[model samples]
Target: MTEIALRAEGLYKVFGRQPQEAVERLRAGASRDEVRPATAAVIDASFEVRSGEIFVVMGLSGSGKSTLIRMLNGLLDATAGEVELCGERLTGASAAQVRGLRRRRVSMVFQHFALLPHRTVLDNVAYALEVRGVAKDERLEAARRTVDLVGLSGWEDKLPGELSGGMRQRVGLARALTADTDVLLMDEAFSALDPLIRREMQEQLVELQSALGKTIVFITHDLNEAMFLGDRIAVMRDGRIVQIGTPEDILTDPANDYVAQFVQDVDRARVLTASSVMEPARATVSASSGPRAALKVMRDLQTSAVYVVGRDRVLTGVVRDQDAIRLLRAGTTGLASITHDDFASVSVDTPLSELFVPAVESPLPLAVTDDRNRLLGVVPRVTLLAALGNVSSHTGELPTVEPPPTVPITVMSEALDAADAESGRAVPSGAQEGAV
Candidate 1:
């Protein structure tokens, strides 16, 4: 079971004296207008961050996402509700207690690089350890190691102004890594960089997460950024969370129109995984099934190819219709002669965008498999294209692939549905073709 590193329940952050009264009135069904102008920065907010997972809290201006984050780290007192870190409750903790927790257990990265202009990069990074009164020699050693970790190896002596925007961000990241804190709080840390620089930072964060396994609470307004970095995202609206799900969940099954509109312009192809788009094979044959049985199953299913599975449902290979017939005439007893591994196979979490080139080139449908290489579903080229096209439509753009004569969008959904029993199908615009 995954362990939770941080938790917040029923949290509210109204910036006024009547917080309790406001909460009571709202709970009693009073219209928000009746609450007057209390600036309810956050209301009834709750979320959990799992150990080693990047959890994102995201929304546009005035959504209270930033306020919620402040509450989590105890930078701001919660108007109501509770927050626990690791396991220690913070709702009523003293100022010193919150400061100690922040200093020793969690680190925050600001949108601005926050590098000290007067201090060298090395001194700036070691400042955290210095604040704790570590010996200068010990602190500098630790700071050097962290600086190298963030890719600022030789710039230890340089001032913040000497570095590029991305480099300065790296310094901030290095500073956060000094004490090996288990949790990181990043509030729009990449929002201030250029687009290309921002992408680089995102990639670096992924690599660092893999290496460090820090529980990160990332804040952003960009859906694309949230989708790219977060293992799970909580979408906020009007100081309240409207949705909490993986990127694919938010895209395919939005919580409501508000969420749908917020992400309507997102690039679904980039965020969607193979597991989201793949459907089960409409027809499959066990390795023990003879040529005749395989042929009959193919004929019944109306597909030209049949997947061959072994014990435990491991996907051994695929058998085409021509091979099945040829083996039948030759009186082949088992599926040995016709089976081939020429088809493409992808893991469930493979991004749909990664499949674009392979999908177009492969003659056979793409197989979606689990960790044990067990067959789950397939992604045919047409089905893949159609899914991409549908996302395009959501962005108010034309789909790139004109539907071919043999395939229609409605038929695609039906085909996927027929195959989607164990591994649900992913269609362009929710089409249901049986498993690919």
Candidate 2:
């Protein structure tokens, strides 16, 4: 079972003279407007971040996402409810206890790069260790290694003003990493960079997460960024969590109309994966089966090719109908001579956007495999298109191949936009199909 690294239970942060009274009024069948003077920043917000998961809190301006993050780190006190870090309560903990916890276990990365102007890059990175009273040489060595880790190897002696915006952000990241904290609270960490640089930082964060396995609570207002990075996302609206789900869940099946409208402009192809549309492989034969048997299986299934699998359903190769017939005519009994590994295969988690090139290039349907090389299913071109267009295929028949469309993803996005416009929703005037 996966261990939970952080947890928030029925947390509320109200700002007013009589804050606890506001909580009571709101809980006792009163609307937020009823508690006029007191503003509820977080209303019964509760969620858990499993170990090593990127749990994103996404909301628009004035949604109280920033306030909620501050409360998690104990920078702002929660008016009601509780927060637990690795099963230890934090709401009622003393200031020194929270300070010690932040120093030892949790770290934060701010949107604006907060670095000392006078200090060198090395000194800024080692500031946390300095506060912990580490020896000068020891902290500097640790800082040096962390600086190299963030791709700033030679600029250790440079000041913050000498680096670019992205580089200074890297310095801030290195500082957080140097503390060796297990949990990271990132509040709009990449929102300040330009589009390209912001995307690059998101990619770097994904790679670093894979390497370091830090539990991250990433705050962002950009829907694209949230879908691309989050293992699961919590959507906030007016200080209340409207929905919490995976990207595919939010895209394909939104919890409410608010969430539906918020995600209408998002490029579905970039977020949906092959697993979402893959059907069971219709024609498959065991490797030990002879050519006659393989040909019979193809004939029964009405497919031109049949996949060959070894023991435990491990994909060995594919045997086309023509090859099967040829081998049978040649009097060959075993299937090894006829089976060929000519088909394209992708992991089950591959995005639908990435499947386009291979789906168009491959002669057969793209094969889906698991980590153990087991053949899970196949994604035919027709099925890929139907999914992108949100067209349901409930006929329970094998998807037949069609002539590959030129720029299918773009066409699908335009189709979605037209549908949204007809429904009287504002369609964003741009199409980006490969953002994932």
* Best model number under lDDT: 2
Error of 1 at 285 (Å): 1.0
Clashes of 1: 16
Candidate 1 residue-wise lDDT, 1-436, digit = tens: 8898999999888776688898887667765567877767887888888999999999998899999988888888998899998888878999899888888778889999888999999999998898888999999999999998888999999999999999999999999989667789999999999999999999999999989898999999998999999899999987788889988888888999999898888887899888887776766888998865675565456566778999888999988766665565454578887789887789988988899777665545788889999998888766676666654323444445432122233443333344343244342342333422
Report how far residue 117 has shifted in candidate 1, in Å.
Answer: 1.8
lDDT of 2 by residue, 195-307 (tens): 99899889998999999998999999999999999999999998889999999999888999999999998898889998988999867899999875675565455456778
lDDT of 2: 0.85
User: 177, model 2: CA deviation in Å?
Assistant: 0.6
* Number of clashing residue pairs, candidate 2: 0
